[model samples]
Target: MSTYKAPLADIRFALFDVLQAETLFSRLGRSEATRDVIDAVLEEGARFNETVLAPLNRIGDEIGCSYDKATGAVTTPPGFREAYAQYVEGGWAGLTAPERFGGQGLPHALGTALKEMIDAANLAWGNFPLLSHGATEALLQHGEPWQQEVFLKPLVDGRWTGTMCLTEPHCGTDLGLLRTRAAPAEDGSYAVSGTKIFITAGEHDLTDNIVHLVLARLPDAPTGSRGISMFIVPKLRVDRDGNVGGANGVRCGAIEHKMGIHGSSTCVLNLDDAQGWLIGQPHKGLAAMFTMMNTARLAVGLQGLGLSDRAYQNALRYARERLQMRSLSGPKFPDRPADPIIVHPDVRRMLLTCKALIEGGRLLGYHASSLLDVIEHGGDDDERAQADALLGFLTPIVKACLTEWGVECTYHALQCFGGHGYIAEHGMEQLARDARITTLYEGTTGIQALDLVGRKIMQLQGAGLKAFLELIEGFCSEHEGNPDLAEFVAPLRDKAGEWQRMTQEIGGRAMADPEEIGAASVDYLFYSGYVALAYWWARSVAAAQTSSQPDAFKDAKLQTARFYYARILPRTLAHKAAIDSGAAPLMALQADRFDA
Candidate 1:
């Protein structure tokens, strides 16, 4: 069986040392997010997850969620409901929500650490509360005051969970093709009818009521996506006075037998004339639903990060204890019958790759969360705008790259165990299976790639990219004279320059041929992600050197950063080459000629 202990030290280092989140929170007037408070939260969060949720991970995976066909209800694995109850009782569900909504009113950046712990501890269990954060965002931004009082408060305080009912039987990514209909009622409510598939946490026993943020179309609306509207449809009807009643035409038709995260119910939700209330204006649902989708995209990225960390921890432990062949050069432990597999160069390479990606990726994800704080609370409008732009640029990259890397890291970790990793008992295969879903859900990597190149980069004129480039340039300029950092700073500066040039080249080509965007998107995203991590790794090395940590810790950071630069950073070159190849090769293959 696998064990999980939250990586609190690395999390704190990324939050305070590398990102200086405490200073940023103070500057943003978030007085409640003091270091002591944040530290205590992290401690309690670690304790709860490690003690409560971690023990249930294997059982959840083994037993999974059971669905009652007659009742259309889901019974989660034995310990899942209890764990969620404890999570709510501990006030963790509202850790970063508004104080007025019975929340603790903490910073989103601080919550990122706790979220990571929960996911790492039990990702299946984590899925239940995950969509609630997204629902809270959608409601706070678009829900009416009465709706907020009825729906958003419970979502925040963890009395009820939330679901984003977006995908339908026929439509996964194409919202314009959806057939869900919302008919207006005389009593100011709407009757929603649709069958939504792959709805996570749609019907769970963890909460009494499930608030579903559903997308549908009104009768007189325009065609396609512009005709869409969002509605709040609860499993059980709730009046404006906040009283819960009987079932409101919402029921679970079926549950998908998935490849991973089985304890988290992936439901087929059938809303048959369910009583619903409009959220935001009609015919503009996609925009409003994006509020929830964007939040889920980032949270999904954390899912990848958490899984990667857990996989790495177990792989490292296995490598240190499992006896294998002696070192290639000579045996360091002559007394032992065989040296540990950690003595092998190839094993070390795998471990180093995991370390580099997990640590650097932590900074990547945390920095994006800090940007949310600035956008919400920053005093200066210009600063807030910059943070928002930077966040927009980083979101797709963070979501796509971290998830793709998660798949890679899990593969490496499983490989470290040799034959044992393939079995069910060792639990490496479970982590690998769970990690697979992150890249596909919220948005596929391909969708994220297109979003980055087409929407964020070309349409927004790469405002986020420009902001990020400035940070790299400024960091390089500040550290150019420091001999200790010259090795990292020089290459980082070079990659930043290359990143800007590549973006311009892609932009120029996209103007002549629009298909170029689709062709260059995935490769361009990978290229940009590598360069971005290069910048963070350099900063991490510098922070480690100057911090009050032990010499061994500093040396480990230095060595790992070197390994990343030498072995991993060169991956950007391949992506750049693919981006430079243009769209010709891909387009040359005629669709009908493939089978010939």
Candidate 2:
């Protein structure tokens, strides 16, 4: 199997050259996040992920997580605990967390680069700490002072891990249908009773405690979503002084048997009146949970990007070495028995497809992460609000597009290896399997589509779309006169205009029939994603041209940008056609008559 290597060069280019994250940090008053510091963090992160986590990926897959039914304990694959200990010792758990809570106080954008490397090296292991970010966000935003005081530090210091327990047996997307119950205790805490399914890292021996942010309905609370309340239910109870004690009512009923990410424990968590504390306002759990969900969604997008890059790297390497039939043009390597498959046009198409999507998707995901810095530290209220708006709008797009593309890119990567790719030894199929979960979890592509069209576009008046379009216009206007950028600028500008018009049209149609939102949502999201990448690809080429980098790097950027525009961006045309078709054909098929 090909070894995992962190693409530090591309990561640097995306963060510094294209995004100008240093300037962003300076403007946002993140004085400690200097260029030198960021570089050091990235370098160390690369080393840790490549050396520590990457080696365990296949082992994690092969051994998986072992469950002890008697004790309700889940043991992670070998080397996982030691690697996690090293990760904690390196102070990576709280890299982007607030310093006041025992964190490094760095920018989220920098943390995103580190996360991509971690996911690429070992996606299953990365799942262990994934929800801790979201849980930290929830606590930071809504936890009471004492709760934060008690929980935040431990989570930041990596002494304990966290989980978001929102899904149940009956409901996955619709939280209103949940049946969890939370009853008040005399000591001012609550008793949370619920069975949360698909809980990642719910019960693990890696940490002394497992912090669960659970959704349960309280007594006298209203029915449906409004009745739901969030609670901090830990596997081991903790005192106000932050002392870990005996077990709470939380237990791992069973660990799921899955298709991929076998190393990551997906648990059926049974909280039988678990000792808990309420977070935020009464019956306002879902609103507070969004804090964690949004964070997780963005992280999930990074998971997709990481897997795509890993798959692409291996595919590219294989294509250059794997000798096959002679090139149709002629034998490029006549001295050898057969020319390398890289000489073939179709193979190049698949490889280029992965390249264009992975690179462009990198900029897209990183840019979204930078918005968090703005939201957290922008100089003015209006600036922060605008950043928040834009972040909200782009979240679903980033989550859905990157993950769906991950599946596509991995497929193309495996296809490049021919029959050998399908075998487990090559590890290509594992990536293919792993990539599938990113789209399905953290709100499926269809769910993200509905969120994009129904809520962000229609209900919120497309504030995020408007912010993104302004960015496109500003870039196009700034580069319109640059002859070097003329090819990309014109097309990007046109797409920006079409994006705005498309939003307006969807909004208008949704006003007449709500089903139009559902029908156009998935297609509209893909359309929006393609246009977003178009803007980023153009920016990448512009950055590469102006940088002090070598000619080869700049040339590759330009070539990839050209390929994206010529081949990948045209996908928006089909999506636009689907959107223009409206909801008539979809609803025309009756429920019972569908089988006919």
Candidate 3:
């Protein structure tokens, strides 16, 4: 196995060349985040992850985390705690946080890039900060001023970690089914009682205290999701003076036994009369939790992105070095006994697939982050509102598409290793295992698909869809006659038009039968994702065509763009066909008929 190295060149190309992030940063009034500062951050982040975290990837997976039922304490694999301390001391947790809250207050666009690097280096270890970032988002958005003063700073500074406790034993996707309860207490606190299962980093030795953002029903709250309220329940109590008190009523009943990401402790949290406080208005906890969830969904997508990148790097290295048989064309390595696997066309297919997905997905993910920067720092309210709408539209696609593609890309990477990939010592299987969960958690692909089709498109009346289509059209129109980009520009415009038409068609059919939405949703989501990636790939080719970079780098970008257009973009056809098929074939079979 090879050590993970951050693809700094491609990252820079995506940020500067494809997305023009520095220009956007300046326009957004983020003067502190100069290109030089951002570059330095990436360099240092790469160094930290490559050295400190990369080496621990295998150990984290092999040894995993150990949990103690007696004390409700979870111990991370070796070096996990010390590594987290180093992360905190380096001020990484505060990178994108507000300066007043002890963060560097950098644009989340840049922070998201740094996050991708960290996740790619060590995903299991990355969960600690990932959850913390989500928790920070919720508090920053909806927490009371005092709550921000106390909880936000600690989490930002990494003195403590956080977890979003939403899923209960009975309810995973349906928040309305949650059985957790929160009752009013005399001291102005609420008595929280609930069991939140599948809580990542819920109980860990990485921090002294764990901040849990739990969703529970209040006494006077309505039924279902509407009745739920968001609560701030700390594992260790804290006073008004920012002092740590004794342990709260929260305990880890058990930890889950999982296939991958074993290093990150996934705990079953028991909140027995736990002292807690509300973050947002009552009966609106679902909305408040979404503040964290939106950020988390994207973060989970990055997990998939990171693992795919890591797997590709390792598999590509192995392919180049591993001697197999003679190439189909000729003997490329005449001096050696046999040619490397890279000489094989089939192997190249796998390598190119991984490369194209990562590079294109990088552009898609980074562009979404830039939109986030616009939301936080845009010049005017209108621009911010537009940015918000665009971000909301892209979130589900970014979360679902990148993750699903991550699984596909990783599978290709592993196949490049052939039989050796299956063995544990090679570390390829672990990537596949870690990737399986990304689509399931943070809202499953099905749920994200539903959100994209039903909520974002239909409910919002295609506000986000229109924004995205306008972006694609603008780009296509800008590059209308350029011979260099003509190949990409034309197809992209056609796809954009088709996407809009498909959206309208689905909306029309859904009006007659609501089941049409669910039936077409997953395919529509995939269709949207493919089209979105095609736009990014075309943008990359356009950037490469006009760049002053070396021929090798520019050629690689153009070639990969071509590969995406030719091989990957066509996958959208199947998705479109599935969407056009509508709800009949799927709904024709009753629930009981599925098993039979």
lDDT per residue, candidate 2, 1-596, as tens digits? 74689999999999999999988899888889999999999899999998999999999999999999999999999999999999999999999999999999999999999999999999999999999999999999999999999999989999999999999999999999999898899988888887899999998878989899999899988988889889999899987777789999999999999999999999999989899989998899998799999999999999999999999999999999999999998999999999999999999999999999999999999999999999989889999999999999999999999999999999999999999999997899999999999998889999999999888988899999899999999999999899999999999999998888888888888889999999999999999999999999999999998887899999999999999999999999999999999999999999999889
Off by over 4 Å in 2: none
The prediction achieving the highest lDDT against the true structure is 2
Listed per candidate, the RMSD to the true structure in angstroms reads 0.7, 0.8, 1.0
Per-residue C-alpha lDDT of model 3 across residues 1-596, encoded as one tens digit per residue: 54699999999989988888889988878889898999999999999999999999899999998988789989999999899888988889899999999999998878888889888888899988888988998898898898999999999999998999999998899998999999998877899998999999999888889999999988888887889899999999876556788999999999899989999889999999998989889998877789899999989888888988999999999999999999988999999999999999999999999999898888888888888888888889999999899989999998998899889987998898889889887889998888888888889999999999999999999999999999999999999989989889999999999999999999999999999999999999988888998899888888887776789999998898889899989999999998898899888988998899
lDDT of each: 0.93, 0.94, 0.90
lDDT of 3 at 549: 74
Judge candidate 2 against the unseen true structure and give its global Cα lDDT, from 0 to 1.
0.94
User: What lDDT score is found at residue 145 in candidate 2?
Assistant: 96
Q: How many residue pairs clash in each candidate?
A: 0, 0, 0
